[model samples]
Target chain A: MKNVFRFLYELLIGKPEPPMETPLYRSEIFPDVGGVSLLLITLVLVLVYYYVLNHVMRTARFSHWYHWLGMLLINAGIAFGYAIYYCRLHEVTPDSYVYWFAFANAFYSALFFFLFSLLLKWRSYNAARTPF
Target chain B: MAKLFIFGIGGTGARVLRSFGMLMAAGVDIKADTVIPIIVDPDTQNADLNRTVEMLKSYKRLQGVAGHDSGFFKTDISKLADMDTRGEGRVKDAFTFDFGGINQSFKEFIHFNEMDPDTQALVQLLYTQDNLNSPLTIGFKGSPNVGSVVLNKLINSPELRFFADNFRKGDRIFIISSIFGGTGAAGFPLLIKNLRNPNSGLQNAGEISSAIIGAITVKPYFGLQTENESVIDSNAFITKTRDALAYYKNNLHGVNGLYYIADNPDTPYENRPGGASQRNDAHLVEVLAALSIIDFMDYQDADFGEETLFHEYGLRQDAPSITFEQLYEETLHRIGQQMVKFQLFAKYYKDMIREDAGKNYYKALNLDAAFANDSFHKELRHFLENKQWGYFAWLEELARNKRSFAPFNLSTQDLNLLVQGKPVSRSFFNKGITQDGFVVRLNKEERNLTSEANPNRKFLKMFNHVTEDFYTSKMPGI
Candidate 1:
């Protein structure tokens, strides 16, 4: 069970063998649990987002254009905040900020968040349309 | 479309008509295409009359805007004034005939002072001083002597004439009145007499008089709260009813069908002679009386015979209070299913709508603004929340009575627990109605309904469709 949990954790955060020796970021000040903690936080944040979305969809028209826009903005903000925290944890160099990989992380996180939120909203909409 | 001219006379008449209107709103099948209700009461300010009139107006307005697509509130109810366009156009635009000159004492109404000494002596011999001095504003106050005189004039008025004129051959007439009351007891026999009178000088008097007439004589089912010199007494109800029935047995005419409904006077209402204080609770007996009219309409023309057919209301056992289980199989099939369906519909609107509104079911129907904000929606809510005779109050009273019709637990705080055909305690365990089961059913039912862009129209049609399907599936026998 411990090995399975570790494998699952590693699969979510990427291969554990990879070193933080890239040009954009290097491990120095942050503890070893930094990567796991950040991943856990992201998981918690996603779960909380899903919870709220479920609640709002129960009684509110969350699929309206304005509501979708609002949801997109919130998800983007969360992803960007997490990206900034990830960079700060690894202590990215100021000169490496302009690197392609530097912004790619944030872009990928935002895309994932956007797609996940969209999927949830669509599911609720479908559930609503389906009669008992 | 044949019309059913329902003459609701006095307080009891008004209450029965109120039940009929509610049943119509809930989509009960009344074979008539149009219902023309003409209320006859001298007391214009009577609470039961006013409440019934207001409810009828709401039903009319709601049915008007709801269009023809929805099955609920499908029965067309047009005012007598609206139907007759041939006159000088001096229409009152009201359900009740104008009783303008009846707000005076009986003596004043007859112009006692204008009579000579010998005529006055004759009038004095015919009527006692109390009968002559009695006011006609509140009502006859159980004095058929006064009511008979006052109500006889209405039969010859232009309103009755217009009613007789506009009435087609296939159309029908039904009179609702209480046998123990002054106005109804006096008016029922008088109205029938005028309708059947061969010499009555009115357009199409013969055809009108000979129309297939049905009348419901409501025996005194309730009593007054307290005894007072000026008010009606409970002790007299039995004697009055017996006497009235005997009179009907001897002199009743024209009516081809008659329905008799009454309940034991276990619960007495406040002792108000007439006016606003006469507002009574909705009883199961009144609902049964309304159902009788529907039953009458369901019959074929060939069903009528020369002899008048008589019917009476009954339950499974002579219990004090009645539950849905206590009803007879036929009664359950006729009234139970429809009652529960409408009860579920009302429960969904009154309790579960807010939470369910956020579901995809509403969004798919393009109801993002919430159908609650619509004017028709507001009007319906207002109708159900009416102070005197709202559906909620009606059901609550029915459940609280001796023959309780407590099919749903309306007192629960949880919207999820609101289930039809089951008690509140058993709502959780009931099949086809779990916490989320109704919402799902609503969502599914919306897909099946014919789409209407109007949210109010869609809301009513969807509820009408879903509740019917649900109740029918859940309790097929009912």
Candidate 2:
């Protein structure tokens, strides 16, 4: 999981911010941000949109393509903010590479959100055909 | 699988049949496998008859698209001519009986001009000058003496013979006519007499003679406006009803079940004898009279005895306006929920379908193109919202007429307060019945109805399920 996160972030933004911080970036920040923000948090937002708001509460107001897009944007925003917060918490070298990594995380968060929606929306009563 | 042949005899009969058609469109339960409505009005230009025919045609088209298993349009209403399985083409393929146009005056029709001197003297004594000169094209003009003689020839008509030929032993016959008018007051007894004659030479005369025959004679429910030049006088309605009752008590036989209904006259309708102008607003009496047809079909064959069973409708309490709570339990059981469901379906179609273009259920069925281009949707729209004589217009007529039957709060846009006396209970968490909730329920029902292949059938079935859920969950004490 760590190598996979390292490969995804590096593929988008190239190397880490400073040559001295490369090991910390690969060892902790990449995996921590990618797993929590992109995969886990995106999955949770998709489930809340499809299952909780639609099926459990049975609301049709949010069962639209635009509403789904809004949820995806929100997940991306959360990923962007979490990546910046995690990087600062680690006291990494202040550079443009950290911002680039957060940008990559936000982009991947949107993709994961779309993937999760397709997987979980079929069983939703009100939003099954939404965003089609 | 017995069929019910309904003979609607005049203007009142046509209006009652219209109400019955509305009920059948709402998926109200009827015991018969098929219903054959034979409208028997000689006034071909009558507005009431024309409107009933048009509504029945629309209903037949929708029923063709949505099969019997779907809740709405569940019953099959067939034309009398369609019953000829052999394709004999003996009768006209129409809802009304072919009268062949009685274009002559009554005097000319009876051949009084060619009578001998002694016969002419007797005819002059029996008929007034106005009665003798009245044209047959407009109808009897409140004169049953002329109608009785004219309608007696009905027994020899080709439609009667065709009806007799197709009637099976288990099938039942129902007749609807008013006791205060000319055509119905005169035609009802003649029809009963002919159908009861076992020796009548028709093919299945024996079966038809012993069949379970029911008739609802609607008494005077509305009066005519006073017109100095008009032959129909409002003052004579009670006298005519009294005379007809006396005649019916002694001479109206062969009916296994006889039902009588009436209401006090409140407003006077225009005194148009019989033409396109003679259209009257629908009344509660007609709707209840239509219910009698359903009630008659509910009885088992063994329920009928040698004596003719008689019935009269009475409300729980007499009021100028009636709601669901005012009806008896039996009446409510017969039609309450079905009417409410159909009304919901109609209201949604009229008010919310346009806004629901992006709904899951709407997109699943591709209702955007269907609503814009499909004939089924167009017919459904016409059935519910047409300005002249559609379902909403029928409801409005009922509400504005004397002794109003306004059970639904039609003017309000709020779905929670739809039923007049039975409002949906709402809570902080539960908005009882909103447009959003309706769409949600419809989406759920659409998923459940995936197995129904036809879009028209699925549309009706989906609404049926959704409205049923709303009725059960949202409306309490219904």
Candidate 3:
């Protein structure tokens, strides 16, 4: 147990050690907020995330792999940890409905914004075509 | 000889031409007048062009391309036509080439020495002020009124062609302009598209009518701030540039590679100067783009390093007030913000596919219309995969080396060091690219380091092959 806690700490700092037990430790960190707040935060996060991710794929070509890869790894670590916490660590554990509804809501909202940004400017929120 | 008829006389087009002009003035150092350029601005070049040529001319002609291509108290584009029609040597000479192009791609270049007696006499008369800009019997969408008259008179008839017969195949001809305003933006594309029917550029010389063409377009820097912009929208201009490229692809029968320039303008104009100069650095943008196109198309070499258009393009100012180094540093900060955004997106991927399904996630990002679809994931993977023709390849080729799309590579720091007139550090560089350097920005302090004579001759330790004396000469050949 001591060794497993040490492994999880190392994963956060970006070390060369194996992560054999860290995933399990991370499972305890997820918190499945029951009711409306969980849904609201998930919805907001999904839309914001979708917009940003697409922007990176389009323009991140300007720098190095670490610039992008480092960011991706950190995000995945947090979200996946959150997933484990919600499904296994908190409350009586989430049913399949929790996973399905949360996932569908996040994906749909994000996708809508992603398409909208392409057709209009976000700053002015103008609907005019970019002319290209 | 490949003759490239570039269309689009806006900021994008003019900046593209500057690269070709700089190469000509700088002289790439290969013997035999290699490539020849013919300029056809619907009017005259703008203040930014006049100033750049003024600077480059010092290395080649300092006082500027001189008598006719003069800067300071310059003549307007409209009056040049009157001068050309009136046997005014400066105006007529401004439009004609003194020698055969380094290559014979321009079909109707109006070669004078090779003509027979009667034809020579006709050619001379055709070249005179009264003939060249004569109006056309039947006008098109953007015809120059008197210029058309002169063109019809010189070509003898609207049906006949002069440049077509003069051009030979595979000759590299570079057409340059800036698309934001004036002659370059309006005239460059017309000159390129018109060449297809064999009536463009006076149609005066030989028998080969058509030749292959290529283009290098330029986009303004992200901030692209301008104080004196008349009718400009930097965002709309970017979109128009894309449409123009698509237009070239759809309209022009044949064109090879469309290179781009996304750099700051390299000029001395600042808050003090107000001689009708383009504040957004549009001219410098056009030239950098032109240089990239020539290197990619003419040389078939494409591993260009990151170039910062704002800071490194000129050695004029002592220490620039607003250079590309700061701009690049800011750019990286923006990229960092984007990383946070993408991390948030991982949640969407989580519900859509399994943890092991890297392939499915990538597909959903690239090709799919829906966020969770396979195409979108594929696209994300394609970028992450760093495939041969993926986004990385494009970024590496165009932006990683220089903020501007100039052929040579100089990081933002390197650019700063060069501008400071400091020597470039080759110790770590000689050992090979450091892993961390993959995202370095170019600055202006390293200005004259790349052009110096090395004492240790240790440059080979850094670059596999050095970019030495690779510029074309200012002297033209027939």
**Chain B TM-score in each of the candidates:** 0.92, 0.98, 0.39
lDDT (10s digit) by residue, model 3, range B1-478 = 2333333343334334434443332222111122323343322323433433332222222212211121110111111222234453432332222122122211133444567889977755544432233222211112222233223232332222323433455544444544333333334455555554444454433222334344544444433335463223343555555655576556644333444445443432243111235423323343345445434443431322232112123322322232323323432232222221121122122222232122211221221343345332334334322333222232233332223332222233232132212223445324222211211100010111334343111111111111111001110110
Residue-level lDDT for A14 in candidate 2: 93
Better of 1 and 3 by TM-score: 1
**How do the residues A1-132 of candidate 2 rate in per-residue lDDT, one tens digit apiece?**
999999999999998968999999999999999999988999999999999988998688988889999999999999999999999999998898888988899999999999888888999988888788
In candidate 2, how many Å is residue B476 off?
Answer: 3.0
- Using lDDT as the measure, name the better of candidate 2 and candidate 3: 2
Candidate with more favorable, higher lDDT: 1 or 2:
2
Q: Judging by TM-score, tell me the better candidate of 2 and 3.
A: 2
Q: Once model 1 is optimally superposed onto the true structure by TM-score, how far is the C-alpha of residue B410 displaced, in angstroms?
A: 2.1
Q: Rank the candidates by TM-score, best first.
A: 2, 1, 3
Candidate 1: stretches off by over 4 Å: A1-132, B85-88, B116-122, B364-373, B401-405, B413-435, B448-450, B475-478
lDDT tens digits by residue: candidate 1, B1-478: 5899999998889989998998888777788888999999988888889888989998898888776557577788888888867656554778987777577999998899999999999989988787888888888887776799888788667688788778888899999999998899999999999888867887777788778999999997887777656557778889999998999999997689999998888767778888767777777788889988998998888899899989998878776656666678876776666667777777767766776554656666655454545667777777777766677877787777655656566787553344434533334445454436565555555555545776677777777776776666655544
2 or 3, greater by DockQ: 2
- Candidate 1 whole-model C-alpha lDDT, 0 to 1: 0.71
Better of 1 and 2 by DockQ: 2
Q: List the residue pairs that clash in candidate 1.
A: A59-B358, A131-B444, A132-B440, B320-B402, B321-B402, B321-B403, B322-B403, B322-B404
Return the number of clashes found in candidate 3.
116
State the lDDT of candidate 2 residue by residue for B1-478, as single tens digits.
6999999999999999999999999999999999999998888899999899999999999999988988999999999888888888989999998888998888998999899999999988988788899988777888788889889879889999998888998999999998889899889998999899999888799999999999999999998889999989979989999989998889888899999999999888989999889899889999999999999999999999889999999999899998898899999989999999999999999998789877789999999999889999999999998877799999999999988999899999999899998999988999888999889988988999878999989999999998998998887588
